[model samples]
Target: MLANGNVLHPRAGRAYVLRGGRIVVSADEIRNADILVGVDGRIARIGEGVSDPGADIVDISGRLVVSGLVDAHQHLDKTGVLRFTPNPSGTLQGAREAFAKYARNAPPDDITRRAERTMARCLSRGTTAIRSHVNVDKDAGFNGIEALSALRDSWADRLTLQLVAFMTPHPGQDLEWLEANIDAAVEKADVVGGTPAVAEDPFRYMDILFGAAARHGKPVDLHLDEHLNPQRPLFDAVFDRVRKFGLEGRTVLSHVSVLSAMPRDAFERVRNEILELDLGVVTLPAANLYLQGRDADMLPPRGLTRVAELVRAGVPIATASDNIQDPFVPTGAGDMLEIGRWTLLAGHLRGDELKTVYSMMTDIPARLMGLGADYGLREGAFADLLVTDCADVDTLVAGGADAMTVIAKGKPVFDTASRPVAGDEHRQPAGSG
Candidate 1:
């Protein structure tokens, strides 16, 4: 404890010792120990009975310690749209129109305020970093772009913000215009995002976009098919181009739910292609689930990408809360734990599969964000961590990381105090007898 209530301070590597918790150093290492987070917000020392007199300490004896979560794919501008109940007949068209209107009418300040609030909520829930796709289509007129850019700047200390400049290659704008604008946008952003669904000739469009990305030395993010019609071959074309350019490990495919509906044989071929290309997959559960099943019958495919298969085949797979109350997804409460729960349940993860589910939100995403070296709980890693209301990974998802504590750069960003209920305090009712 500090002499004052304030958590901010200056010291020569004063140790922060979290005593006696089940420390999840990584996905596999879960051990009971005193983990010391040193000054400058990195793990300095970790072991049993590690003590320091000048150190600040917290007793997390009954909880679990985990690395800060990361959402590898998200949409900052689309996060404030209210959740709409789906209309069986008007699902796709209605949702699209609603979002388009939201994008047009939403003021820049409103977008920035909502995105900042969403980022705070995500941080409170232990998501410390996110790569958000801000729609940069022709109609947005710098409002969305400026808003998202400002959001990234304002929260730079707490979050790792990667912008995907999503382009609109409408007929009037044409192929050449799209290429020129995309090249310029990369200099202004971290990645180049496009929608193959919006283009009449998606193959040719992807070629242009990917080529531009290679030329600009930026990554490629695609809002692939999230529809009931499963015949879109954009993923195939993506794999081919990435392979041809040898841009392995630099491309990301988002919302590829249509791939789930493909036959096993066809999926095998495409999956193999994706693996050979070594491209990354960002599964956005919130948006895809809301957008997909528009024309479904008895069996609605899980709108998630083939995460388990991809991970088993050594392909990098990550998760994101694409929208939080935005037009496309409607409502995403900005909680990654919620996304993890949906992933485990909807993706049929059980037993040991829980570890894989957990990785999607943690180290795996850190790798995607290029922070692998300093992402986790090991010594010399950043002191960004979460104290969860769980004994292990399985229980954490079930309990929703409740009563959690979030630490960023070795300082408490959020802390929840729990009080026992009156007359039901830690015992059975007396009237039961």
Candidate 2:
């Protein structure tokens, strides 16, 4: 029995104690013990027979406790608007056109409503941290930034939301207007971002983004090389800019889908450079799979980065649900486990490979977002955790188990004993989910 006089169960209590669970300290380490969360919302201790008479104990003897999930890339402002704006062609350009049309007429409150719903869904599914890229172009204005900034503060107690000002300039658009708007966005956002591949002058695009980021002392997260054209490669130039600005670990490139189309020798050379530069890569499998490889007539290529090779080469790789039910992805629940499942199948991850796949959602992205030493499930770390029904990673991935309790900073922000059916479990065809 707990100090609060409540029965020991999944929804027992968040009163400073969690006991009798299989705690996953890392991908390779799992221990049966108790976790004591201190008053400062951090893990005070983890061991056997830890007793605290004054604390509320939530017995999870058969449950699996792991770190709270992290989303390295997301689009908060554009979430859950798929029904209003449909992309008939199912291509990148189609998505762009549809979103542009919608954003042109959307008011700030509408954006806030949709974003709030999306974040609520994310919290319900055990996501504790997310890095969202909000549109900063003329159509979106500063509506997204203002709405998401308020949401970030309001949800600060329950979730860590980091905003990146995503500058998406179309062709023939005035560069001066784009740069000025980006400057404004930098003042409001935590990270500076742009789609370099979409810029008419890719180098100049990198210059504007990096210059503003350096001036503002913000990190860079760019959408780079999302196309499958082997002739056009923007990674080298992006790497050169990072080196030139001495922003090695401070830069992240999302959706380098062309890397999967590279030849073996070229891929190896590029992989080595990426490692040397110490850059982070975020593979948005959901959006890439839906948007890319549309023009191929025979045997369309899988639109994904070389995740297996990058993991093998010791490069930092994180996977995310980029767009949720928007014109780009058309379907997503903002669940990292679903993203992990997709990554596993799309990347051909099996056997021992599950460890890396699991890390892509938890530790790896946490590090990339600069969450520091307080992120994981170790003693003396912040008590942000997720307790599920499965005992191991293999079953968690195979079964897509629901997180019974999602704790952030020693507090259970979301918990439910009712196990919802895993939406990724054979609900649709292979690639559709």
Candidate 3:
């Protein structure tokens, strides 16, 4: 809880009227407008002459304001542990082995600290929403869930976090490990997920995941086909289970790198099914670029799935930063703009497709995370926004970490122009500002 004498000394009922800024309301709309934030922390009005007599009116001329970026896929616990765990082989299995060994003894506080550092980086760079996966098998157990769930409550005022209880089938990681821990994990998790593609019986693995999610009415986000094999039995299995379990519009498939290797006809057919099923697809460009295609003897291809084509097909797609400074990719700062820029360059999407790329960062993933009207810049919405010096969305993506201010729930919680790591504090209560 925040004391009356908390450092910022701002109350939750604090109201503000931002004036003269170029607000990017959505991918299709940009306008010079003023936004009035009410005492209840939602946008009261937005127009040319919006005003509140008692509200603090800040002049934001010459600034670009947009909704804070949303990261759909990430690993919070494994972030910032590269030095403690090294993957010399630089393959997915090597990264898994190195991290599993380190996690056998990973204390809860250490996990919280690593997650805190990475989240600070993300928030400072204007990513206010994230869906992070944590290991829930034998070696990792449930320590990560306990640690991050607390952070989820403490940080709710500024950032939205969705936890995925990720099941692993690494030998003994199965058997009694999931049976003992999965129920509790699902109750505490925002989504239930697992690496079904690697399981001995992929259908059985999905049965476990779907059953747990059904028990709690939670959503599903699974990792499958994390390779280049065009044969998509794993994806086919996922589509089948989603249909069988009535999980349509509530399932997300991450790291389906096999989609890139599918034949043109096959991709179109699968894309049509995805459209009908309303399943979400996530592409992790950075980690895939590092881990995929290592076995190729000649020039390596870009390790991402067919991003532009999938988006063109009207599938619900998101591009995200999967691993940050971990054994998975070994390099990242958790910047969504960096992720956006990399997606544009690596996916071979044309510059004219900038609006489509911007949607991945703000709209598509936010909807999947269940953050809808309250997330974006509109009347009656929660006033979480990113104000920067860039003139437009394209400029913001091209310029990595320029000085900016992050506003959460209508209050200026973090201003990079004046401070550092201010968003990391979880001590203050949300209502106390």
Q: What's each prediction's TM-score? A: 0.87, 0.92, 0.91
Question: Which residues of candidate 3, in runs, are more than 4 Å off?
Answer: 1-13, 418-433
lDDT of 2 by residue, 160-197 (tens): 89999998887667677778778888888999998988
Ranking by TM-score: 2, 3, 1
lDDT tens digits, residues 253-301, model 3?
Answer: 8888888888888878888988899989999999899998999999886
lDDT of each candidate versus the true structure: 0.72, 0.83, 0.82
Ranking by lDDT: 2, 3, 1
Residue 19, model 1: lDDT of: 73
On lDDT, the stronger of 2 and 3 is: 2
Top lDDT hit: 2
Pairs of residues at least 3 apart in sequence or in different chains that clash in candidate 2: none
Cα deviation at 55, candidate 1, in Å, is: 2.9
Models, CA RMSD each: 5.0, 4.9, 6.4
What shift in Å separates residue 142 of candidate 3 from its native position after superposition? 0.6
